[model samples]
Target: MADGGVDEDEKPVGELFGRLIDESKAYAKAELGLAKVTAEAKAQAAKKPALLGIAAFLFLQAAVVVLCITLALALATLIGPLAGGLIATIVALGIAAGLGLMAKKALESGQ
Candidate 1:
């Protein structure tokens, strides 16, 4: 036996190559397993924040709807129910269209 602990008759080239390949496969499998566990942990950490964000978004949407209804009703007192509702609808649609165009432009620029 050599000081390095290898036999004086070195391993054949094919045998060494096979060992290397097996070790490489084992290393790759370990890395993949670690990555999967890391991803799962990150997802679990984000789950609560993601749910809270969705809830906040829904609440904001409700608030916007309430504001629109209030505006329509207030206008109704002055003008009339039908005309007030129409005006409110038109205003909301115009705002939505403007925001949509802005969002589209932003996305296009980012891409």
Candidate 2:
């Protein structure tokens, strides 16, 4: 106390408190940076298997598509006489359109 009141030249107690706050912020920033790095590593680990699963699913879809094509061809042959030649033509056109759409989808997917 100076002259029964706060000192004029003496530093405010808030300055020291401000410095402590700054140091705490710096520490928090460093800890956040570390957490970001660790989270990225964990995300990479998690993504690997999920990506693999997607690839596997895509491959399976392709295989099923191939099987579908074979079955369609076989059915087209069998159904030709039973449904008549005109009906067979319509079916063939439908199959061709379906195949065109499938190809379009494949191209769009780049797979």
Candidate No. with top lDDT: 1
**lDDT, candidate 1, at 30:** 100
10 residues in a row with least lDDT, candidate 2: 80-89
For candidate 2, the per-residue lDDT at 65 reads: 65
Tens digits of lDDT, candidate 1, 14-95: 8888989999999999999999999999999999999999999999999989988998999999999998998889999999
Q: What is the lDDT of candidate 2?
A: 0.80
RMSD of each: 2.5, 9.3
lDDT of 2 by residue, 1-111 (tens): 678586755758797689889999999999999999999999999998999999999999798667666656666688754455455456657888999999999999999
TM-score of 1: 0.91
lDDT of each: 0.93, 0.80
Instruction: Estimate TM-scores for all models.
Output: 0.91, 0.53
lDDT measured at residue 108 in model 2 versus the true structure, 0 to 100: 100
